[model samples]
Target: MKVSAEIAGFMKRLGHEFAQPELLVRALTHSSVVSPTRPDNQRLEFLGDRVLGLVMAEALFAADAKASEGQLAPRFNALVRGETCAAVARQIDLGQVLKLGRSEMMSGGRRKEAVLADAMEAVLAAVYLDAGYAKAQAVVLKLWGARLDGVAEDARDAKTALQEWAQANGMPPPVYDETDRSGPDHAPIFHVTVRLADGRSAEARGQGARRSIEQAAAQSLLAQLEALA
Candidate 1:
């Protein structure tokens, strides 16, 4: 299938013009689209996840000579997480070109973090399939610019760090509560509170999964604690 002018412009923004334009088409197709002839991006997303992980792992390994596996592991997780993938997808405006079913479109699937992240991975796989691993690596490195540089510094999980601090100070473990859940079912917003035994607490709002929201709330509390210290 031929790509539309919009997809052509998107390819320009993505920094890679496809030799086989059909790959790009497949990447943008969501499962909800209901195409008998055309396939969704699920398989491509799986491949892209592995490819992205390898690229990030190699990049981290080369960048940090003395970092232990412990240090590099968290950095790798940060780079390959759904939030990071969604950020990259936003950079390329991938949502604008996504092919969703009527229900999904009406529900704002394009703005969902999980959808964007999955599409981003599929696009990476498309690039890899269209050209080669080298080209895909180049694109990933370029798209993920600056994030790679700062990832090492921000690699530590906020919740984990906060827990360690609490344990070291002989305090009980931090508790997380979902204070509020709002918005439509398709795109819910979670208000999570992270409270410590010492009564210092912070709340944060996050969209998407409850786990991510809780993590965000923990991060907010950790930042507050650090600032007070």
Candidate 2:
């Protein structure tokens, strides 16, 4: 099948040439643009999620033969989370080739973390279907290169760490409040504040998802507390 220049460029960036080019096209199509004849990437996303999880789990297990399951779980979560997937998508400029609907495009769907992450997973499924598990594993490892090495540090949940710090200092757990929200419904920005019993507080603003924003706020508060120590 003939592929467009844009898709060709994207293939170069992705480091995988699709044998079934239509798979890649479907992978790039979002739910907003779905029809009876033209399907979306949701099914691909589901399958790709499992493929990604298996790859990461196997890689993590092999990388650290001595680490406990507890130690590895958070690391796996850190590597496969939407935020991390979005980061990988951004690295490959995946958003540039996405086929979004008019409404989604108007709402900045290309830049949205959730959209990018889901599309990234679908692309992985496409690659898997086009080639096989070996090619898909190689692509994932290459794209997630340094992240695998730094998974240990990244696995530390800032909110949990902050709460532990507060408990150790004889203070109550910190409180997180959603101070404000703005932007369109499809892509809203969240402002969150985290405060401890001792009045130490920090605020942060983030886009895409509120939970991620809350985590960012917690991380900010933790940083401030650590700096004063």
Which candidate leads the pack in TM-score? 1
Clashes of each: 0, 0
Residues 39-83, candidate 2: write the lDDT tens digits: 999999998998899999999999998888888988998999999
Could you say which candidate leads in lDDT? 2
State the C-alpha lDDT per candidate: 0.91, 0.91
TM-scores of the candidates in the order shown: 0.91, 0.90
Tens-place lDDT per residue, model 1, 1-229, is 5778999999999999999998999999999995789899999999999999999999999998988898899999999999899989998899999999999999999988899999999999999999999999999999997899888554877888889889999998899988999999888989999988989898989688787888888888877878888
- The segments of candidate 1 whose C-alpha lies over 4 angstroms from its true place after superposition are 169-172, 206-209
| Lowest lDDT block of 10, candidate 2 | 149-158
lDDT score, candidate 1: 0.91
In candidate 2, how many Å is residue 156 off? 2.3
